[model samples]
Target: MLAIIGGSGLAKLPVLEVTHRQVVRTPYGDPSCALTFGHLGQQNVVFIARHGHGHSLAPHEINYRANIWALHNQGVKGILSIGSVGGIRADMGPGTLVVPDNIIDYSWGRKHTFFDGPERPVVHVDFSNPYDDGLRSRVIAAVDAAGKQAVSQGIYACTQGPRLETAAEILRLERDGADIVGMTGMPEACLAREMNLPYAHLCLVVNWAAGKGGSATVDFDPATAEAGMNDVTAVLQAMLS
Candidate 1:
């Protein structure tokens, strides 16, 4: 089965045909919410809203370890994480969908690894390529099948946040070659790697990054996010079909 981790603006999947809900327990702690077991067309999927169902959890406050462990324990073979991001590149703007090929993590103060503490031996997982290649390709194909255009590859900058980035910080990320910026992309991607789960991230650009696109302030519109998620739903449905 495939696992889907829904980030900001995707508290619930639009295409899911709900089968049941499960509150999975893990050694780490509770996941963000109950796992929704459902069918997207004929495909079986398990989903978790990264933030709480009401969108109360901040990026740093999310229990990444527990969330990952819950899905891993449920025997999901692959994971697809969907997030809302700000456009840093000229081509990335509101409503644009992206399948990021790589990522840069600026996030901190979260439980990033399972390989910690006195009993566990330190293990180094190769992160030379952060995203799973095959899954990325499949998402790209799904976008095509969904009749939606997506930036095939880009660098995602994961920032620490309850607050959005400062103008200077956005500038720094752009200099670091980040094409998009978002809050919840880090440990989630790496933790999936540690579990050897094939994982891919799909992003929706909801606004221009701070100080970009001639906007003095970052303006976010819920309507834009809703529209972008509609596109994400189409791709996921196509992926399942």
Candidate 2:
């Protein structure tokens, strides 16, 4: 079964055929929201809002362990995560869609690994290629099948934030070879790996990164970001179908 984890601009999927919501209890605690079972394009799929149903939790505050554990316990085999991002690459402007192949984590003070407790035992998982290659290919194929143009691969910079990045910070990320920037990509991707779930992400470029394009001199416009994400929603619907 496939699980869809929705981020900002997508708290709910209107296309999902309503089934039921299950509140899962995990060792780590509660997930952001209940596991939503439903169908997409007649295929059995589960949906969960990475934030709460009311969009209350911030990226840094999300309980990644519980979220992944709940879905895995429900027998979800593949995960498709949708997130909003800012373009760091010059060509990846607003309204662009991308499937990231790599990620750089600058986040700190978060429970990044499942092997932290004394009784848990230390275990290591090879993360040479952070994302599942086959799943990433499938998503790229889905995008093509939907006739939507998307950047086949890019490097995502995962930042620690309940706040937006500064122009200098974005520039530093660019220098570090990041193509896009966002919060909430780190432990989520890592935890999915630990769970052995096939995972991939669909990133929506909502705006230009700070110090790039026209955003160099001013703050990002929320209205423009929402408009760009609306286009992303259309593409996602088509791809899922």
Candidate 3:
């Protein structure tokens, strides 16, 4: 089964056919909420809101371990993570959907591994090529089948944030070769790797990064971000279908 982890604007998948919700308990703790089971076009997909359903959890506060473990326990083989991002590269403007090929993690102080305790043996997963290639291809194919114009790939910068980045931080990230900026891509992707789950991401460009485009002098506009998310929602529905 495929698991879809919704972030930011997506709290629930309205298109998912009603089935049942299961609250899973893991050694780490509870997941953001219950795991939602449903079908999309004959395919059974599990949906979980990375933030709580009410959008109460921050990026740093999300239980990455519990979320991955719950999905793994529930027999999920692949994961499609939906996230909202700020475009750092000029061509990736608002409303663009990108399948990230690489990621630069600047997040800190989060539970990053499943090998921390003495009870569990020390384990290490390869960091190179973080996202699964075959899964990424499927996502790209899904977008093409949906007839949505999506950027095939880009480098995602994962920052530690409940707050957005400053102009200087955005510049630094750009210098680091990031095409987009987001808050919740860190341990989530890495944890999935540790669990050996095939994972891919569909990044919705909600706004321009600080110091870029029209957002250079002002804060990100929520209205614009919401509109972009609404467009991506349609693409998501088609992808699932």
Q: Which model scores highest in lDDT?
A: 1
Could you tell which candidate, 1 or 2, scores higher by TM-score? 1
Q: Write the per-residue lDDT of candidate 3 for residues 86-153, one digit (tens) a residue.
A: 99898898788899999999999999998887788888899799899999988888777777778888
As for model 2, its CA RMSD to the true structure in angstroms is: 1.9
Question: What residue pairs clash in candidate 1, if any at all?
Answer: none
lDDT of 2: 0.86
- lDDT of model 3, residue 239: 63
- Clash count per candidate: 0, 0, 0
* Model 1: CA > 4 A from native: 214-218
How well does candidate 2 score on lDDT at residue 232? 58
Q: What is the lDDT of residue 200 in candidate 3?
A: 92
lDDT of 1 by residue, 2-33 (tens): 99999988999867999999999999999999
Instruction: Please provide, for model 2 over 46-116, each residue's C-alpha lDDT reduced to its tens digit, 9 standing for 90 to 100.
Output: 99999988999999999999999999999998898999898999889877888999999999988888888
- For model 2, which pairs clash? none
lDDT of each: 0.93, 0.86, 0.88
Ranking by lDDT: 1, 3, 2
